[model samples]
Target: MKKWLIFSILIMFGIFNLNEPVLAEAGAADLTSEAAVLMDTQSGAILFGKNEEVKMYPASLTKIATAIYAIEKGNLDDQVIVSKKVFDIDGTRVYLNPGEQVTLKKLIQGMLINSGNDAAMAIAIHLDGTMEKYSQHVNEFLESEIGVKATHFVNPHGLFDEDHYTTAKDLGIILNYAMKNEDFREIFGTKQMKWDGESWDTTLLSHHRMLKGEIPYPGVTGGKTGFVDQSKQTLATTAENGPLKLTAILLKSEYKKKIYDDTIKLFDYGFSNFKSSQVKKGEVFTSGKRQFTYSADTFLTDPIDEGNRTVDSNGVLNIENREGKVIQTVELKPIIKKKLEVKNTAQKAEQSGVLSLNSIVGGILLLFAVGVLVLNRKQKRNRRYRSR
Candidate 1:
């Protein structure tokens, strides 16, 4: 009996573990390039890519980090001086001539929108006393936030330096992280923006096909474009449609147009390949308080065995996942009935099993006690009859 009890307890443990919800692995991507990636903004699902981890010169793509750092350490309205060193920066200048006055905010717009190498230097000079210190700041950020093992930097502008290099995968990750910030999303998405009495726009409007209505994607929401004769035409582009947000990063395309073609193709694949399904809502779900919902076809991997799920009309849906283990319960202060209805509706189209373990133990205990009583009675009757 003791051995049987031990075995039963072990089986109970197995049942408990079996009821846990298992998570699925991330989805993979398909793209043709030296490196590339696509992901659902909210889901963190990797939709597609090729050679994503290969390290290469990021060129002006380096400005994404520069832009992010400036946003954090420098205020938008803060005044910044354009050092003589910063004003003379070659390649993609926001046209910052020597002694030119500009606000930190407008400089950021210049840096991001124009891919200004000089803006990077000016912002760096102001924040850390020098661009070198600012680069150190970016390096520390890379280690803490990006978890990039192979990335290093020598400049904020992403000009090719032997010491400056990053993996395509890491750049994609940084882009995603940056896009979530409202400041970044707002800055990178604009086709044309002016700051501090300085005008900035996407370089050479002829380069952007979206401006010409060439790509069918909703429109370019925001992103940086990159190139080094050696790095080829490296492009990072993001687009928004109705409910979806997508980003693509490509390195070293053969033709300039290839950058545009590849970006649009990746976006098309994401928007076309999967339907935007709402998996969860962050809100408490009051009045409209459903945090999570499943479609009619949504079947719980394990179904509830008993109790059609009871709510005291408080709108709390109490559901048991087959093992009498509750999987989901929501209580909304304003309406508990609505919570119950949602719980019931979620389980409606699904067939589930009944809860299996409660009464068995109770029945066993009762039977054992009864047998002990009967045996004692028999022994007492035998003793009494013998005495008589």
Candidate 2:
């Protein structure tokens, strides 16, 4: 009876809430897809994963590279003359006829939204002067900036190539890079994009159908869909749900609808089971020993719009190590009427200020000279008065 009483009291204080880690059995539902990953879109932490690092053909998903390349290089207004070879590429297409005219920007939208293989070829050719050079940029970016070794691309479109490959883990890395780029994120998140009244007089009216649903998930923003007989079906989706905005990628899914369903399940699992840490408003993180104080909820003229990230702070980042010790996040802000650059300066003025040693020494010498002259004149006057 006494042991039970003590256990109950400890639980109330949260000293030992359960005295053990809660091992959730990630149900077999997660294993249905050959590869899957759920990640925190902000901090890029993996919440759940299966066969994440396993190598596989990424199919149309390869266009992730193509889309990013187009965003970086091509201007929407730049007219691309349909090359004879681009119109003839053997895959999906916007059905460009040779001698046709289209903007590189619209071609990209078609490439991503319609998964048009020929559009992909057209955009690739337009951006780098040839498909070959654009593909080199993709390879270098994957290995260098994205830090992905398992991912390699042969085409701007994710058409099946004997050499092209990626994994669920590599997709996470790519998304991490993509999320940081405003243009890339915007393209990925767009539900519908319509551009009309240009010289070519065309609009890319993208209807990513699932994004229109109002019932279960109003937060499903936007993402990409990939499929081919060889790659089966692949979907990568993202959403903003309260404090957590997250993403889930599914490869070799059955149909486009299954991509939505599977992605929804993965997101549901992440939101229902896992919760992230919050740094509160007006919270002060202080370490007197280190002479540091980090304050949150600082005032701006307008309330800050947390676009890519969100926070809930009772007031501060209670940063902790593995041992659960508080490592302070130094809160820093400007003081009134002071140059912001001066914040790095020391308080000791003469000891540490901008004036040099010779300047200070010269001032001291001038003061000493004046004092000696005054004393010498007073002594001379007193002797002359006594003699008179």
Candidate 3:
């Protein structure tokens, strides 16, 4: 009997353990780039990073910011005359002649799809009148609109400039922000478009290998490529698999193939290990006596394996990996029901007090009226006795 009982307890323990989630072993990413980051497009969570915050040259990746900025701030339908400065600008060109009239939208397409330095210069000059003002306005737009801190651009084109620099993380943020805009998304993902320039009238093909089907990634939606002597082989790529959308940024790889390879590794790790989880707007979470909920639906990036969520006293929801490291934190709005209940209770108490005071005043007035009637009757009786 004793042995049987011991066996039964062991079996119960095993069943309990089996019911709990089994955490998969964490994956590793080996990359060749000097700085890289893989971010969740929906939740803005960083899944992998190698010196992501370190300052590095962005090369033509600068155009990602430039393209999005122009699309939002400039009128795409407006006709922009190509300026003389566009012809002399260095690096890749769509080969526009001086005084060539092109729509602002066409210039943006040429700049993004073909890495046209001339197109970029034309757009910059057309929108802001000069490169100097364009740089200042674009910088302000990036900081105020997109919330990038460690980036600055002296020129719209990513030509070699000592003052122009951005980081892998910042590039990821910019790409993520840009992808939300419809016009920017359509232009950024174009693999090929017809070019009708004064000097160059042919097809403009994307320089990104994966985007152009040269590398053949499965879910590659958009890409931007950049390189210069100072900033070697920079690349930005966005991909989607089912419900997961990811952005990968790589900077300072010696070889183009190596940067592409690094991007593949980052994507593989992200898609395999992480999954998206949703928090509905009205769903409530409790922390002791407090309850928290979101006003709008939001998504969270969670490990495919075991993870935990904890709500703190301040209504902050912390999502942690299996190792107890916090991967994401969301500030939840406190549910105001409890506060309303307390206020209602206080109001009732105040009303009760007011009613009690009213009752006391009524009783006093009743007794004073009765006393006045009795005194008037006594005075009338005394006057009747005197008359008798």
Task: Name the candidate that leads on lDDT.
Answer: 3
The lDDT ranking, best first, is: 3, 1, 2
The alpha-carbon deviation from the true structure for residue 205 of candidate 3, after best TM-score superposition, in angstroms, is 1.0
Q: Per-residue lDDT for 44 in model 1?
A: 38
Tens digit of per-residue lDDT, candidate 3, span 1-388? 9998987898877853644432222223357789988889888887777888998889899999999999999999999998999868888988999998999999999999999999999999998998889999999999999999999999998898778888888888899999999999899899999887778889999999999999988999999999899998999999999999999999999999999998898888788778987789988878778788886788898888877888977778888877787767888999876335788899999999999999999999999999999999999999999999
Off by over 4 Å in 3: 1-29, 339-388
Candidate 1 C-alpha lDDT tens digits along 121-148: 8888878887677778889987787566
**Counted clashes in each candidate structure:** 18, 10, 0
Give per-residue CA lDDT, model 2, range 32-123, as digits (tens). Answer: 57788877676566666778888877877777777776776567788888777764677666677666778877677777766678778877
TM-score of each: 0.61, 0.63, 0.81
Best by TM-score: 3
Task: Name the lDDT value of residue 347 in candidate 3.
Answer: 95
lDDT of 2 at 182: 80
Q: Is candidate 2 or candidate 3 better by lDDT?
A: 3
